[model samples]
Target: MNQRRQKKLSHHLFEAILTGDARSTKALLHRGASPERRNGDGTTPLYLASVQGEAEIARLLMEAGASPDIESSGPGSDGTPLCAAACWGHTETVRQLLAHGADPNLREDQGTGRTPLEWADGGPHPDTAEVLRAAGAQPSPHRAVGAM
Candidate 1:
């Protein structure tokens, strides 16, 4: 397929994942949309799914060959799918990513070098933090100014 068409499909897939519509997401993927393709804002389908706690979508993306650790583009693009999941307190998404080989120690590109653990720590998800720690995530020495 042409790059333009593929990108369009990817964008649609991104939206489907964001809205937790696994059916459309699956249809898009089956139609040649790349699970790893980044959206206009540099986020991937898996990242958006993770951020929204769409565990089933995340699993489908991973099973379709999406990298658990794919980084976003542009400035401050250090956010991995794992980071997005952790930041949003998506425990099941985090578990799925980790099971898919996501790096627990990944830090945000523009943040205070906070790992998934740090992000989870500041969020309302202590269980997420425990998952990160169990997966070998370590806290960054300097927390973000607003980090809890």
Candidate 2:
């Protein structure tokens, strides 16, 4: 596909993710919308899907090769997809992200920010915290950023 078409598909893909439209997301991705493409908010399709708790969309993005651990760029609560899901108490989304290799212990902002566990723990979500803890997430928040 041409760059123009790819760009359009990517744009539409973001809309589909935001709306939790799994069918559209899947079609767009099948037509070559990049799972790795970030929106104007600097969030990938998977990240947005996680924030929206769209587990089916997230799974599609992952199957399309979205990096589960990639951080968001736009100024927002979202850092990693895992962080987005955890903070929102999206247990299934968190589980999907972890299964797809998202780093449960990874802090946002290159490690200086909160880990998924911390995000979960701080939120009104004990179940999310439990998921992270089961995944081996750490409780301490002072890890060196960019040390990964």
Candidate 3:
């Protein structure tokens, strides 16, 4: 029950998510591991899955009760799991998160003053921008950098 041991277990679970190892993830959860636990950067297993565009991983995390809307708790908390997926043009990931109740219009990290729409704009991928807009992301006056 030491802190270091718990963190090690969490990190193992986190790695399983990134590798899309559903079986291991399931086993970890079944053993009462915490999927919602965050990393040093406040990145949860869901966040890693979204960023990696691993649909199975994302699904597993969601089913385990990880909050799709948990912002980074870091500066701005601007990084929603959906936004991170969108920023990477992970259409399926974005769709999954939205279906699971992630707010497309979730506010961006503070000071950055951006939205998922803005994040999409900052990327070079047109498909991502389109997907975000289609998901009801709007054009705020904030105008994310490099948005077309």
lDDT string, candidate 2, 73-115, tens digits: 8767358899999988999999999999998888788867778
Best by lDDT: 2
The lDDT ranking, best first, is 2, 1, 3
User: Candidate 2: where is the Cα deviation over 4 Å?
Assistant: 141-148
Give the residue spans of candidate 3 off by over 4 A: 1-6, 73-78, 110-112, 144-148
Q: Pick the candidate with the highest TM-score.
A: 2
Where does candidate 3 clash, by residue pair? Answer: 76-109, 76-110, 78-108, 78-109
Worst 10 residues of 3 by lDDT: 71-80
Query: Alpha carbon lDDT of residue 139, candidate 3?
Result: 77
TM-score for candidate 2 = 0.91
Name the better of 1 and 3 by TM-score: 1
Estimate, for each residue in 2-85, the C-alpha lDDT of model 3 and write its tens digit.
788778879889889878888888888777667688877777778778888876778777887888888665342237788778
- For model 1 the local lDDT of residue 91 reads 96
Candidate 1 or 3, higher lDDT? 1
Q: State TM-scores per candidate.
A: 0.85, 0.91, 0.80
Residues 39-66, model 1: lDDT tens digits: 7777677777887889999999999999
